[model samples]
Target: MTATVAIDSYFTPVPDEIEAIDLVVEGALPPELNGRYLRNGPNPKPGAPPAHPFVEPGMVHGVRLKDGAALWYRNRWVRTSLFTESATRVRPDGSLDLAACHANTHVIEHAGRTFALVESGLPYELSLDLDTVGPCDFQGRLTTAMTAHPKADPVTGDLHFFGYGVRPPFLTYHRLSASGELVQSVPVEVPGPTMMHDFAITEDYLVWMDLPVVFERTELGVPYRWSDSYGARLGLMPRKGGPVRWFEIEPCYVFHVGNARQDAAGRVVLDAVRYDRATFRNEWDLAAGKEKTGSVPGQMLHRWTLDPRTGVRSEQQLDDWSLEFPTLNENLVGLQNRFLYLVGGGSVVKFDTVNGERGVHRLPDGAKPGEAVFVPAENARAEDDGWLLTIVSNRIAGTADLLVLDATDVAARPVATVHLPRWVPSGFHGSWVPESVVR
Candidate 1:
């Protein structure tokens, strides 16, 4: 059986529609190209798409979006000559320029009037705004592929990014000024060379979840697969800046980023989904006469809390079925209260983060959800009192659309649906930004 579920519903592409922006949605290294000798060879499975496509790229790697407008990253380039915008690419200064950027599993944002973290290095703050998409050093070496979902401190306005240190795979944090300068850089120990994914931060601490270890071999054997032998840890790195500490978990239970909040008891609460491996085995060496096989558990969704001062923590598993991804929406109902949301096999759930209470609603048959955003309710008194924006692709139709849900009563029908002109490939992650803050 496949590790990840198949895409049940996918939307159709519009061949004649004018394509505006392109983003990097998912990544993978196909089997034929990942072996010890051959870097990129012919497909091992003829006519079948590789497990990972981001490792090898096609032309037109990056997508450009203007202020307040967001685009989905399609692993493949969507080309169109028809236009509301110019077909010939131009620089931020309106000069004729042709450049392609390959940004897989990284954050792309326009903030503080001008600046962008395009490639996975120091974020280059620009002098121009969204209209002036400035030049970026496309060839810069990355210490670690920058993870998406960067958080800006509400108190200090400092943007924090989590990355892997290249020479050796250690987790590192880079703080950027509002002006886009790399103000500080610090290294944190994460036991293994965690992949470019699986790291997060809150007001007081940086959180690194169970990440995959990159072996000495250059080949990444499986797409989006983590080890069953190495134990996964819930690690914490202080924002004030200090040593990294890890809390262990049974290996094979993978973690994904959700909403994080501090509780009244001085503990930080994280909502993460953990999945069990499909296979497991313990092997014994004849000479050593010892046994060692990593344990892979069944799928579980859990809420974990950790105290930095005392290093104490607790965990509570929620759903019996799989809970793939969970996101926290603060102040959706009100700034004082917060809600936790997640997408599973065929449903979306909204729960009270403080308590464990929640509401569940299923989606239309065959609709695969991408990232989500919280839009304020149309009016204060409306049912559910908030809007949940999700991008779902329909399998039969082969088309993707924006689905607006009622957060208060998620089971309630969709309030609005924005149909896009083409299919949007699945994306790893994304977040929302208010229009007022764009300028």
Candidate 2:
């Protein structure tokens, strides 16, 4: 018999759904930090190893905070149609049911509703308490899958996102009004089925990454592989959704975008963590438990400036350190922001975009912190005037801590550390829903 694959640190699913009440807090919790911090990630069934991390079913882990206290911690698997059915189900047309998605990539709140999102299917709505509500199709308007990384304009409250598939009409842009109505869905022309994980939005334009990572037909895991023949390009389309102008760039893959905005000269500036073709493929294979040869290059914080009028593009690396899961203050989305928060290199780093300096909150040896979620202070005045919440797992101690750091001074010690009952595996994107928004 084939030996069972050993579970990686991230693929170790919790044995049971757990709830720990009245968690011990080490430091003082910020009074304004009132609400829930929910993060979604893949957690496969026990003894059922998935072909890849991305295909595992989604489980959401969350922590509730109010009145400067850690109220409770809870985790639940998102119940999609895929999780409920016993037999293999497919549509009559041969297309997989998008509603049956794992809903594992991200957890976000918009228009008073919380949604767990995966790029391959419709979003699964969850209750404020982190319980799965059901799959939401935006009142039957969203025919295509919703992106995991949807940007909500801080000024207009409008949500902007897009979805890509393996077939023709491969990409489509979506817009939702502040009131939660699906206002528009426009089909965008692209060359082929590229794995467009995340995009960016500036004040006047929406940026699209059409890299060389193309989807191929395979019987096993995710069928995406790096293609040299498929060129790398970026598409700039007006915010109002019109014609798109494309510009070629050096081949690279960006899993997440820090922020984007237009400079004084009307050039579009974009910041993200970039991985080269070889690094991207090797990492992909490593995540799938496949052996790879050669050293794996790290993802660097990179920037690109595009001048639409002259069709000139400039690229540069912002830092030498490796990082991923970059986030900025939501209030500064689509606008000029001075700081970017990221997780990698065994710590949570605050990058000063303006001064090119960095502040880091390094985890203890043998501990790893997940993506840092920024919780803005009530009536905040400055961009970094908030708290950064992240789940730190101590592999040696077999425990985890909900770490809260002052956004303004991340390098200092954590303001509060909530001791968790169990260790939580590293996961994807999360959101901090204020109490007012929950109500």
RMSD of 1: 12.2
lDDT of 1 at 341: 72
State residue 3's C-alpha deviation in candidate 1, in Å.
29
**TM-score of each candidate structure, all chains considered together:** 0.66, 0.96
Instruction: Return the lDDT, model 2, position 130.
Output: 79
Candidate 1 C-alpha lDDT tens digits along 53-72? 33211111122222223343
lDDT of each: 0.47, 0.86
Q: Point to the candidate with the largest lDDT.
A: 2
Predicted structure 1: lDDT: 0.47
**Residue by residue across 62-111, what tens digits does model 2's lDDT show?**
99999999999999999888876732435878875778778889999999
**After TM-score superposition, what is the CA distance of residue 290 in candidate 2 from its true location, in Å?**
3.2
